[model samples]
Target: MEVKHERVKQCLEAMMDSGQLSVGERLPSEILMAKEFGVSRETFRAAVKMLEQEGRLLVKHGVGTFVIQPLPMIPSSLERLSSIGAMIRTAQLDQGESRIKFTKEGCSPEAASALGIKLGDPVVNMERVHTANGEPVAFSMNTIPQEIAGDAFDHDEFQGKLLQFFEKRLGRKIVTADSEICVPLHIDRHCQRLLLHPQTTVLMLKQVHYDEANRPVLFSRDYLRNDVFTFNIRRTT
Candidate 1:
């Protein structure tokens, strides 16, 4: 026999997936929902709590339960070299960064290859979580050659965009960037760190940025929530 709470949860999930319940729409009262699901109020409440914990629903103390909105979508063109910060702003959404970690470390093989530097060379690494409307939407790890970062490189003064920081702070203009898109095979580890649902779709972009002289100046790995980002590529005959 199916557990009462489990059955109720599945029905609620189906309703939301089918668009029967829209974001910010309140669910029926507990008594009504319970009766409709053919379960007791306790069982229905348990189901609601499960969805709330999974970030699918919001429960208010004095108010009612409402479907939680997913992260806002940001549309971008592959033709433009746009930063994550710029994307959020273009969408007219509030941008924020958290879990920032900046340090000098030995370059990894991947970073060394991307930046065209010898392995084990010193590099400046910056890791951060990007957020929109107080919701985490992406995680990024960026590496810069020690020669380019220089002694004047100060992480504290970094605003949001790395491209802007390079241009304004270091006088390094990025003329071009190459990006490769990939899907993560395992996103559970990232989900736990970003407070995302385990089933959230994620896309990863590995990039190498070059200056006007064609020298690679930066390498980065960006993991973004598919719910929040859309990239368009124009096709011409």
Candidate 2:
């Protein structure tokens, strides 16, 4: 049996699956991996590089390689937005939090425009550091217009699901909304602190939630760890 790219990929996957690679854990060097797997150093290096490109791992020029813990999975995505709380819970993960602040304030221009409201309108401006398996994976900014958001001002409910609050608590089920996904230039400090890694790219999801009445209810911006989660766009003919 020869140790090749496939074998290296398998070994790495197994380590992650078994919790041996735990998020942020530095991987053994290529030389060590080659000797351990009975493969040439070049072969091991190539395998490591592939994983890095796939966003399952990271490599520092002079330092070493490290494993990146994946985000909560969605079932065969086809361009539908899923609730973060629901996604986290569905994975059977016990949700954990270290809250900084959850408050109500005036909306920013971007938020106001996204919701199609005036510049200084009252908005439910909320912030939270979302974690998965106790590792911070996203910084969430959720804003809703006070006129339409209606009683969304309740701070306690923000701890739960904002999407659900819009439907059940506020009285409307979302039909469709605009969602944009892209990688941002700078990762926020909160992300760096919570993720415990330096200068990783951030995946930005900017969404406007609309109701069955074709009215906008919520506007949200999520900065996710790019190395862990990816948004797939499904096109229909």
Candidate maximizing TM-score? 1
TM-score of model number 1? 0.63
Give the Cα lDDT of each candidate: 0.84, 0.73
Best by lDDT: 1
C-alpha lDDT (0 to 100) for residue 125 of candidate 1 = 91
- What is the per-residue lDDT of model 1 for residues 69-109, given as tens digits with 9 covering 90 to 100? 75433359777888888877776779886678889989999
* Model 1 ranges off by over 4 Å: 1-75, 187-192
Each candidate: how many clashes? 0, 0
* Superposed model 2: Cα runs more than 4 Å off: 1-78, 89-94, 98-100, 187-195
Model 1 lDDT, full chain set: 0.84
lDDT of 2 by residue, 145-231 (tens): 777666646656544666676778788788686888765554555445445576556767788889887878888887777655555
Model 1 collision count: 0
